[model samples]
Target chain A: MPDTLFKPRMNADIKRRSYYSKFIFNSHFLIFLTIAGGVFLYSLLGLLQTLESSIWLDMIAALLMSMLLLPGYRSLLKPADGIFLLPYETRMDAYFKDAGRYSLMLGISKVITGAVVALLILTVGHDTFVISLFLLLSLLHYIANFHINKRAINTQISRIGMTPVLFIVNILSLMLVLQHPAWLVLSLILLFAMGKYVKRREHRYLDWNAYIEHEEVQLNRYYRNVSMFTNVSHLEKQFKRRKYLDPLLWKPKGASFNKEKMYEFLFYRTFARDHDLPMIILRLIILFGIIMVWMGNIYLSVVIGLFGIYVIVLQMSQIYSAQAYLLWPKVWPVDRTFIQRSYVTYSHKSVFVISLIFGIIFAAIHPALFYIAVVFPVWGYLTNRIFSRTVYKKEQELSD
Target chain B: MVLQIEHLTGGYSKTPVIHDVSLNINKGEIVGLIGLNGAGKSTTIKHILGLLRPHSGEIRVDGITIGENAEDYRRHLAYIPETPVLYEELTLKEHIQMTAMAYGIGEETALERAGDLLKIFRLDTKINMFPTHFSKGMKQKVMLVCAFLARPDLYIIDEPFLGLDPLGIDSLIDLMVEERNGGRSILMSTHILATAEKYCDRFAIIDNGKMVAEGSLDALRDEFNMHGASLDEVYLKITGGGIDNA
Candidate 1:
């Protein structure tokens, strides 16, 4: 709570960042950034010369500003703070204030880049006053969006949903402001609505666990993004926090939150977070959907749907396989059969969702055969049941 | 008796690492399973936990053999390994919740007990944080919190103090004592002989894949003929030499 508490922590964090920054901002990254930035700037300037004032430019400006304006809140809070800082939690607001300042300072380059892009493109249509007003509205939206996001960390609210809605609101507001200065009132109202929606809950105290988990997720994201540019040691846990899909995850209540259903709990998380499974499954659906749409032949669509269901069902087995061998299942007092049952439960809903997507894709390709789209889910359920049986057999053999 | 092992001999492979190792822990007792490296302490613990099939003997918890009723056998026992083994995906709170679920404890009751244990170990607030990123000591504390939260009859702890700080060690000792007072049992395998001598009610010494001597401190001293000797001294004398003890 003391002003001094965060200073040393910030310095240490800076040092740690500097350590990884060298790896991230290596010669290769600089080269990539320069060439990519140069090409993008050149193309934009060239477009500006030929382009006229139009709504398309306004749309682009709105979209770009909205996309980049959500500079994520970073508190730099560690897991230990949940314990070590509890006595001082009431007074830790000063520390978080420091963290907010640092985060904004850290995000200045991103905000500026967004502004520059907006300014560069807005020059296509608008005069100085409107452009200035648009920028001012965007900056206000950015600040509001950032604070709301920070507040969401301490509540049970869905942060994932807030982000996309923020994106849409930013785009809507920026476009309205650009349309006419009088519309800025609507933009301001939209921003206030978002703020009210986000901060609806009252957090009596800091949710240290939430804050720390959020921090770790952010840190992992930084490392994960940087790892694409260069190898980083901190990216070992490939858990992509798919917070959006979490609503579908089993929210066990008092009665259902027992040993009989622990695996069901784990199965949902493993499918969503661990191993690139969800993304991979989503990609498979999209890829097969594309193929089905491309080859509009009804027969080909059915074939793609069958194979897609088969592949996705097979993919669902991986989470079960990974969990079966973990130490806790063996140690936990529950029967191993419960794990297989949980797998079936997980495969049931997840495969159905994937199959439904494929079905829609099929329906898009063949409108008259909508009834046949039902076969995809049936086929998916059958394959999953069979695959789950195979897993049980394999697990039985291993145990035997 | 909470855990009854009769001449249990087992290892990962067909060849036994612990041979004819017999140990019994009574209700309300804290028994230390003392041994050197490669001295079959973990093998014995594993056999008791039903993780390894004994080549020669059998183990029972709460008068139930694993084959008779595996879940019931496991339900009565909790094992904390030398190195903390945790789920990479589950958060600390989930681990405790999973423990409660596995033990058939009511969700609210398990959480209430876990809250008390977590507070004792200074981990109540970090419950939602993942253990994967925790330091070794913090992870060990999580293991302790989960194990104690279960309130099982017999706790099998292998090198329980390996990664624990002094405060953590003290908290664990206090919890063990409290659990014992509540008529539960603990089978702890620790290298910290001094602490074990001071706290553990009984001592079981294993050397060369066999339990050589086991009893109370004075009882073990009588068997080893080392009157007034410290536990380290008695342990060395039983295991035969510092070379193998190290």
Candidate 2:
């Protein structure tokens, strides 16, 4: 029965991805991806042309490839399975074997991608034989490493402690293999020893609770990544108490704190304490700023500024979508229209702030075109005005 | 009447879970919406709260229908659900503040009332903590604190005694009586008849998504021809009689 469950679960996961992929790869995101990828490739090729053959290239390739090792273990196991499947633990070997095969396929795809990315720089000094040997060894190590990760979850081993140890070993193994094909034997031996360590520490039964929590974390990480491109209705929002920012957060005074402005207050708090929204905005500004400065093109900066506002405004819409669907809002004494109006008020201000960051970056890039800064905030306000209505339309449809 | 539900027939979908469920609560009354599991207790309450639209009839609070003026209608009532639903990002204190803001209460007055309720529920020290991470009972107390802070004309509480400890239930019953004495009304739904019988001024018993009986304990006993029967016995008799009749 457990083995029969795995196929449907994997198919459902794939179907969910396919559903979200439509919105994630929509025209806006595709355009952004094209320009961003083009710029990154251009810069990388330019930098590579300036470099000569050296250990730094080998170290860089090794580091990047090592980072991709230890691919995540996704069992697709839910929290309730711990209770429901506990009595059937003795018959779970086939179920787990299927899960191992699924996870290995996922890890191998990443290993192939890493090898392709590393090959760009690895070709400088190393011949084809040396590179092939190192890549082959890395793939083998990853297969071994994934089993260690899976077994560690079943044992009393601390996962956090095991990660860095494996990471360093991965880096060392690759570097050694790059130096000589003979070192592949040493890498295999090390991998064997680690497997023995986990086998020795294995629990009598599976740790259902730990694996379930691990799966949830991986699921949330996937949602968080997808949320950057489009709203994820199923995302489990994580909040942080940034107490130091409370002084900066506006306090509603006198008349402004009434029923009409209640949602406005919540909207602001939602944006501020969200574990990702604030940081995502900051990271985008810095990243786009670096690219604009490096390219030093006036037209591109304009395009970048406007597009940054558009992306951040799209992100801000998630905050409204999050709040509107909550139970309290449906039951609150405030009028239903207050939320849309409050969202408009909150989002316009938020977008303006984000636009200001873009504008400032643009101004610093092109000091001669300081007046162009005005267009960014104005464009941000207009984008929010038009975009938030579509969100309200969607929310209204859901509620109706 | 503080609340009047007349011939309400509604459900989550086209099919109605509740059938012509008529009920009423006058000022200063504590009415127990008594029912078994899946007996439309929650559906009736949802209709009263305007969460689910009635398929046929109307629900009124303070003589105002939700369609006529939703803000005015909702302003008169506050709801505490069976399971505590909290803003994951907001602190306990902020929850009360949100209720006050939504109800248009002054900040100082809201906090003043919240302080008394918090002390009664023994949640004053945890006011700064996020109620989302609270234990089940404590989270229920946070719901209570938020609802009571609004001081609305009607309080719609669903299974108020489910998650509470004995002391917490005592505090809740005391608060309900206090609110009743102050001329406010409460409509609480629960299957725990023993707890309901102690404090409720009246009872509305629903069985199989229908209002099987409604009245005072004496009126119920007289109607059912069970003299001096306990509420649990009377409820079982009413609901069980339906099973036999079918």
Candidate 3:
């Protein structure tokens, strides 16, 4: 090879930004936000913004904030996360030195931030034991986090399933600190020792392939959920990149009558049998609950109900957004009727029916306002009529 | 007739990817489609599958036009996409059963065929497992199994061999031969000239949305005046030499 043409491989540092970005958008962030936001909003509103309501909420806020600070605090796992720099296995010790400094700083930052927040809340009670215990528990949380994170980064085990285990341990420790004051320092030391042991054991023997594979799997699942916001293909591409997406779902088992039937089958299989429906259901419930909570007056309830209707309609529209024929129909064994009929039957009619079902359910929940139910059929008709005449027509016209 | 395309001219939009393309595969024939990355192989397959409508052409399955009876037209052909498009929600077995139901294949037969396919693909252990857990090769195998389970008259497969292990490739070749011998026709597009040369009875080389040269390997070799050359040599000579006008 010519000396001038020789190019060194790209360093892993450059790839770390994109990798961490995937974690930020993963469902874990969403779950964390739901928990943190719910508590914050409830405390602010329900307690009339009282500064000294409950210690547990403050503890939760600390935990949630610690999670948010993870990107910055990831340096604490230098021993485990540094394995990426091991290709030059000779310089592994040098990489570990830098990584350890990074991890300790990050680990300390998380511990301090959490301890301060908990201490602020604990100050209202003016109990030294409460403040000391909260600090100890906060330290234990960082230690526990460092341990699991190293295990996950090293072993490539999914961190999502491990979260519940971590959460249980965390909650148990928090309870012990809050309700039992004597064992706080001892427990904190024990947790730190445990985390150190895990890091040492992980460093002793590591399987890089298993770790890389697990990381991609975790990243794909995270990215897949996030990609829904902007694009489905992005998520699809992520799975493709990770070699994670499976083809077993849409495999041909037998004959489809024609392209139309094939499309209809896809539409049904995509929506009715797919997870998007349950997701749709969940969003509806959440929105309904929010509306119910804020429905202080009748007028507000109706306004929320109308907004709910729009949300349902919007959600139903998303059901058909994943059209495979848009990309993969070149070798399909059917006709133009399949495309045309699929739009009319699959996208147009199906969404209309789903909106109606949801609309009626929303109406039944508030029967005192029976007049809202009138929008059920009107919205259904109007949506379909508008979609068929404009969108569906545009689709067909473009098809030609 | 197993599959037929006449004067097909269509693409994503008005810009036709396949122009006036015509081809046919009768019962028991394996017709290979050869092309470069952007050679419109997939577009032509899309037209045949009814994913796209020709600006001016007709595609028929079993002598019946697709538009005249949409259901019947799709019933006759099974398609395996280059990259299998599968639902993330459904389990592997559920995918098989649902497809069987759509095609109106009896449940018992679908299950038996599915089981056999799973065994052949070494996926018998993962029947209940979701595609989420499957490897790329495993997912591709799942797609193949699903297509094979259809047992349609025409099998339209695109880039069938990519991502397969040697065992998988061998099994696929055996399956293709078995399917063809059993009176089924196959329309497959591939860049693996060696594999196509070995298996395909006839072939059509398409370039930039136009049919460049099409015939048996011997005929293609003779046309290029490279009698003893392999399919790769013939292909390179024909493509590198440029398309001679019909």
The better candidate by lDDT, 2 or 3, is 2
Best-fitting candidate, scored by TM-score: 2
DockQ of each: 0.43, 0.78, 0.20
Candidate 1: list runs displaced more than 4 Å. A1-237, A241-248, B244-246
Instruction: Give the TM-score of chain A in candidate 1.
Output: 0.60
lDDT of 3 at B23: 85
Which order, best to worst by DockQ?
2, 1, 3
lDDT of 1 at A204: 81
DockQ for candidate 3, C-alpha atoms: 0.20
Clashes per candidate (backbone, < 3 Å): 1, 0, 16
* Sequence-dependent TM-score of model 2: 0.95
TM-score for all models, in order of appearance: 0.64, 0.95, 0.58
The regions of model 3 sitting more than 4 angstroms off are A1-148, A155-165, A172-184, A204-232, A236-280, A283-318, A324-400, B1-29, B34-78, B82-85, B88-155, B159-186, B190-201, B205-213, B217-246
Ranking by lDDT: 2, 1, 3
Docking quality level of the chain pair in candidate 3: incorrect
Model 1: how far is A172 from its true place, Å? 35
Cα error, candidate 2, residue A339 (Å): 1.3
Q: Could you tell me how far off, in angstroms, the CA of residue A216 lies in candidate 2 after the best superposition?
A: 1.6
Candidate 2 lDDT over A14-104, as tens digits, reads: 8988998998889977887798778767877787888898988999999988998887788989988999998889988888888888878
What is the TM-score (0 to 1) of chain A in model 3?
0.58
